[model samples]
Target: MLRLRRPNASLVLRALLVVVLAATSAAANEAEKAPPDLARGARLYSDNCGRCHNARGPAEYSDAHWPLIVTHMRVIAGLPGEQARTIEAFLRASNNPPPPPRRLGRLAAVVPAAGLSGSELIERYGCRGCHVIGDAGGSIGPSLRGLFERRQADWIRVQIQTPREHNAKTLMPLYGLSDAETSAILEALRAAR
Candidate 1:
């Protein structure tokens, strides 16, 4: 005869936590290995899914649900793995848009990014949405890695000021960065390598 005892709840919870953390770490590691290009992802998502999925907002789906949905859609639409991954990244980012402006009587106030650190400003402006900084970001634009090494400060400044000057069809938004802000962002881009 043999007797079996079930694992205690605490033991089970600890096991579950370990499993969850391991999965999260693995996913993060995989993401860093070859980050998806968000700009391209958005375009692909629109192109492949716009007609059928237009009625549903991405926010309506759970984060965990998207990969599965994208997988199924990929099979149906014959999307390549790279394209599917890009679309997944874009969908994940779009799941939560930035919060609306704070209201003050008749005025709407924005939390200014003027004084944030270079990295913070980069995040605030969503530069990674189009250009890969280090191992992350979209592939729509040139990688910011070795940015300073390749482009002169003046040239980068011009690009920052008027992106269209560099590329006639550039999709980058003009941030109208102040001298200080511009310097900070440039420094950040330089350090991204």
Candidate 2:
């Protein structure tokens, strides 16, 4: 009688890893092939939409609302179907909300209350419509890429609290954020570096 040997655990694990890596690489290649051109979308938006009303940034609206708004705008503005779709893609990509913070469960007791990050606060307040944060945000306001390098914590806090105090002709509105919100945003900005 002939006996069969079991597969080695290490061999099985290596096979699985190879399969996973292959799948991941294939999916990444597919994605890269059809990547959306946000610059084209921005230009289209400026040329077409900016003709009438102020061209609102993508972050101004939620993902769900963008399709409807884009459809409406497409009809009103007489935009081509492909251009409309491209614009919609850009808006959806830009306004993509961050995932909700994970709950710590039992660890919550031991860990300090870590509030929302700077990016989160910025999104919550729709500041991306005016300011550029990283590669995703708009350019109506100043780019906050190196905000900490230019301004101090107190200055930032004061500017958020009272925009006019910092700049005489600032278009930024007073958000009237609470002290906790202010501190959380400030901490996030500091931690970003």
Candidates in order: C-alpha RMSD to true structure: 11.4, 14.2
Lowest lDDT sum, 10 consecutive residues, model 2, at 103-112
Tens digit per residue, CA lDDT, model 2, 1-193: 9989999999999999999999978865665577666556554565677678876756577889998999999999899866776677667765643443355465442323665665577666655555655665565567777899998879998887667698865655555555566666677666654
Clashes of each: 0, 0
Candidate 1 pairs with clashing backbones: none
Model 1 regions lying over 4 Å from their true place: 1-114
lDDT of 1 by residue, 1-193 (tens): 8989988999999999999999978876786687556556655665677656552445667667988999998899888866788778767665643343234332112233445777887776567756778788754456788887888999998887666688865555555555566667777887778
Q: Give the number of the best model, judged by lDDT.
A: 1
TM-score of each: 0.43, 0.44
TM-score for model 1?
Answer: 0.43
TM-score attained by model 2: 0.44
> Which window of ten consecutive residues has the lowest lDDT sum in model 1?
101-110
